[model samples]
Target: MYPADLVKPMREELSVVGFKELHTSTEVDQAIKQKGTTLVVVNSVCGCAAANARPGARMSLDNEKTPDHLVTVFAGVDKDATDTARNHMVPFPPSSPSMALFKDGELVHMLERHHIEGRPADMIAQNLKQAYEQYC
Candidate 1:
């Protein structure tokens, strides 16, 4: 597990933008199962997460249509929560710094790590925005 001090700022990057942090399996399950569209960000301490994923997620919210709930689970930090979130993302292998969108508790869209790494933040945001337009 990562020391809390090491991840506080990283967690704040999303928290400051209104993404609720899910630190336990139950919290993750509850957040995803809530009514309306929910966006789940499996956050990480990797370069792509800092350079692309988090920023892209924040940028995506600028859209007129957005998910009803925004939540995140920190990989390498919140083990149970991250694992639970990954279980919901089945069919796709687990990847850090990933994003998933769910409508009425069903997975609707997903952006895996490969989709974020080496990509510009705006391009990732545009991809998510497109998903939001359709699923949100």
Candidate 2:
């Protein structure tokens, strides 16, 4: 795991953008169950995540009908939480720097790592924005 000090900045960046950190299995389950609309960001300790996915998710909130709940699970640092989150996201394969949009506890949309990697932030954001309007 990366040092807390190193991850603090990333955590804060997402938190300030209204993304809640799901640090426990209970938290992950609670965040996704019986919800209106939720966005699950599977965060990664990678340059592409820093430059693309996280920023993309942040910017996506500009659209109308944005998720009522926004949560995250860190891939390596928060292994248990991430794994638990992945379990909740059954049928969807594991992918860091990915996102899942759920409506009323059903997975509605997904953006995987390959989709997020090397993309321009705005482009990624735009894709998320579209999904937000359609599903959130």
Candidate 3:
């Protein structure tokens, strides 16, 4: 493991939520570019991440219809990879604890930080399940 001092909590938040780590820019691109629907979760260490986004994502994943691949880019921790991943999400500003659902290399659904902060986890999960139904 890399130093826990930097990236552990960020990783655990997503891991516990069932998201796979995509540590390299190449891995991020590969997951985004590969076949089938993919959910790119921009995981973060913010309170919103812990309180709403991560738990919500975990619940959504329990639904029968989920994305083919669940991947995460940890903001601040994976700076360049996160920046590169954000590039693929054009027109949206960078937001920690955001969620982006992609289909066949194109962005389809995006949940920004403002959409996540202070919301109920179930609400967030509902939105995610809707995105999964539509795109995944």
Candidate 4:
């Protein structure tokens, strides 16, 4: 696991935007299962996460259409939580530094790591805003 000290600011990048940190499988399950729109961020300690994912996620919330809940689970630091979050994203492969939007307990939009790594933050935010407009 990455040191908590090292990832504190990274975690804060999302938490500062109102994302609750889900540290256990149960927490992930309960958080995502709620009614209304929920945004789950499978956060990670990677370059692209710092460069794009977190920034994009933060920017995306600026949109008028936003999820009712925002939460996150660290990929390596919270293994069970990450796995539980992935289970909600069935048919989609598990990815670090990903984003999943669930509405009424069903997965609606997913932004995998491949989509985040090479993209600019504004582009990623645009993608998320589009999803939000359609679903949230």
Candidate 5:
């Protein structure tokens, strides 16, 4: 895991935008079980994450139909939490810097690394906005 100091700003990238950070498996489980739309970001230290995913997620929240819950689990720093979060994404392979949208505890939409990589932040935001329109 990256040192807390190095990853602090990365964590802040989302927390600053109001995303609650899940640092434990129990926290991941409880957050996803909430009775409303929830956006779970699988945050990471990858270049795409810093340059695209975090920015995109922040921008996507500006949409009219934002999720009721916004949270994140850092992939490398919070391994247990990240693994538990991925468990909620069964059938979908794990991917760092990914996104999962759960509606009343059920997985609804997912944006994997392949989807985030090579995509501009605005485009990623647009994709998320579309998902928000359909599911949030």
Candidate 6:
């Protein structure tokens, strides 16, 4: 597990913008099962996450249509929570620095690690905005 001090700022990068950090499996389950659309981010300390995924997710929220709930699970830190969140994202395999959209408890959209890595934040934001337009 990453040191809490080391990950704190990374965690706050989203939490300060309204993303709830899920540290337990129960928290993950409860967040996902909530009504309306939820955006779940499998956060990581990778460069891609720092350069793109997080910025994109924050940017995506500027849209007129946004997920009702925003939550995140840290891959190397919140192991149980991340595992449970990955379970909810079945068939996609677990990947940090990934994003998923769920509407009414059903998975509707996903951005795997490959989708986030090497992409500009704007592109990722636009991709998520499109998903929000369709599924949010």
lDDT of 5 by residue, 7-108 (tens): 999999899889999999999999999998999999999999989999999999988899999999998899999999999998899999999999999999
TM-score of each: 0.99, 0.94, 0.92, 0.98, 0.98, 0.99
* Superior by TM-score: candidate 3 or candidate 4: 4
lDDT of candidate 5?
Answer: 0.95
Query: Candidate 2, after superposition: displacement of residue 93 in Å?
Result: 2.0
lDDT of 5 at 1: 76
lDDT by residue for model 1 over 1-136, one digit each (tens)? 8899999999999999999999899999999999999999999999999999999999999999999999999999999999999999998999999999999999999999999999999999999999999988
- Candidate 6, residue 125: CA error in Å? 0.4
Compared with the true structure, what per-residue lDDT tens digits does model 4 show for residues 92-134? 8999899999999999999999999999999999999999999
Worst 10 residues of 4 by lDDT: 88-97
What lDDT does candidate 2 reach at residue 46? 91
lDDT by residue for model 6 (1-136), tens = 9999999999999999999999999998999999999999999999999999999999999999999999999999999999999999999999989999999889999999999999999999999999999987
Query: Which lDDT values do the candidates have, in the order given?
Result: 0.97, 0.87, 0.86, 0.94, 0.95, 0.96
TM-score of 6: 0.99
- Model 3: which residue pairs collide? none
Deviation from native of the Cα of residue 91 in model 1, angstroms: 0.9
Off by over 4 Å in 2: none
Q: Where is model 6 poorest over a 10-residue stretch in terms of lDDT?
A: 4-13
- Clashing residue pair totals per candidate (backbone < 3 A): 0, 0, 0, 0, 0, 0
**Best of the candidates, lDDT:** 1
Mark the regions of model 5 whose C-alpha exceeds 4 Å error after superposition. none
Residue-level error in angstroms, candidate 6, position 35 = 1.0
Candidate 2 residues 7-115, lDDT tens each?
Answer: 8888777889889998998888888885699999998889889999989998888886689999998888888899988887778789898998888888888888899
